[model samples]
Target: MMDKMILKRLMNDHKNIAILLDVLAKKNHKLSEGEAVNFALIRDVVEYMQVYAEHSHHPLEDITYDYFVKKFSSPCNQQLHEEHSSLAESSGALMYSLNLILSDVVISREKLISDLKAYVEMQKAHMQYEESELFPLFAKQLETDDWDKIKLQCEQRLVDDPLFSDTGDNIFEDLKEHIEAG
Candidate 1:
């Protein structure tokens, strides 16, 4: 039951992430076209993603992947775990770049646009890997007890996806409204 619930949330979270990615891609295009884009909004997206990924999504995945590896006597993909930290760093750098511009620091629009494109692509590819590889592996190999264990482990570290939750972190209210309004 918990496994299924976590799986459902993970899939839904990916969809939400995709929407943010599209927003970034579109904003990047606008920036490239010499249009003024909202730097704070871009920063909001990155900040919220880092918060959710670090606090909720990645930990849930770690529990699930840990159980899978334990049961099957096979190693989880190194990238699956390493990508969390790597993406965090990447998102942090992107936010830093946005912060610099927001502070009136001169930055190259083309460089920022390129970074945004790369960031969005990286996120999409990461989601695709989990959906295509790890998810199916769990469905096929993990036992009922494994699911229950993974579920219990998840409960121990549960954190709501702030952007989607009614009682989410207060900092994300504006970003939530923007996503809902979009």
Candidate 2:
């Protein structure tokens, strides 16, 4: 039983990630003239996806999925788990390709774009699945104690990467400011 607060926080983080994905997708499509597909910004996006998004966020979902699987023998848990695996695999492959391109190896920009597109699409679909199917189920099923446990696990497992340490601070501050302004 995941905490409602934890689920809410996870959903908020997912929204932030979706925004970043949109920004990356737009920026990627508008690659500067003569700029490699694996530009610095592209690397940053891939790093965030690999470290912050996949590494941190997915583990929480994995725990939630585990609980659901144990609680219900329905097909939903199995399908969601499969979707999670697919998203992780696709995102990891895309990150690897981006790293290769960043390693000074000449690669086709088209291929990089293709991989990125696929990754983004997969992520978008996965997010929708979580929001539409998984989140509501969690909210209904998880007790406060379950949520507290999940929160503790999330905090303990949090990765302290440069992206999270540096960029996250400013981004979240800005978000706070924006919310306050409104």
Candidate 3:
């Protein structure tokens, strides 16, 4: 079975991503008003989503889903895999738009907001699906060996030098603290 601790940690990470999504939404709103885009902040959010959310979260699910496909070969695993594929594509598109925004390419503010909103919506829905369906299946049906493989893959995929660290010394901490204190 998947480790309960790992699962919980993953959920916490998802929560953090949700929080970041809210912040990004606000930032997108400001940008649409022709306010400063805050490229550094945007970069941080993009890096976090790409590294922790996509790189870590998706690989873990991929491993878990692979095991499920091997054992079940049913519609459940197939459906989840299809959703993952769609999520991955959306994420890639979001990243591409973010890059353009950062580079000061003349992207329409409306289009940027729309794309960003789409990414956030898709991710939130994807998480809900996993928590409600895939996670329970994993808790009930996954073997210890299956979990071990997941852990190994997750460890291997972890970025040793993340583009932006969450160290207390960073500006992100200050931003988060300011948001919390308000």
**Top candidate, metric TM-score:** 1
Residue-level lDDT of model 1, residues 1-182, one tens digit each, is: 55477777888888888888888888899998999888898998999888887678888988889878877788556888888877888898899999999999998887898888888888988999999998887777876767777788888667777777677468877777777788
All models, RMSD in angstroms = 1.7, 4.9, 3.7
What are the TM-scores, per candidate, against the unseen true structure? 0.91, 0.75, 0.74
Q: Can you rank all candidates by TM-score, best first?
A: 1, 2, 3
Least lDDT summed over 10 consecutive residues: which range in candidate 1?
1-10
**Poorly placed runs, candidate 2 (over 4 Å):** 1-3, 32-38, 72-76, 152-155, 159-182
Q: Rate the local accuracy (lDDT) of all candidates.
A: 0.83, 0.68, 0.68
lDDT at 101, model 1: 92
Off by over 4 Å in 3: 32-36, 143-146, 158-182
Residue clash pairs of candidate 2: 2-147, 3-147
Q: How many backbone clashes does candidate 1 have?
A: 0
Positional deviation of residue 113's Cα in model 2 after best superposition, in angstroms: 1.5
Best prediction by lDDT: 1
Return the candidate ranking by lDDT, descending. Answer: 1, 3, 2
Model 3 agreement with the true structure over 1-182: per-residue lDDT tens digits: 55554465566667777777787788888877788766666656766676666777677677667767777775554666677678678767767877787787877778777877787787788888888977887788866776766677677764432322444345355445534754
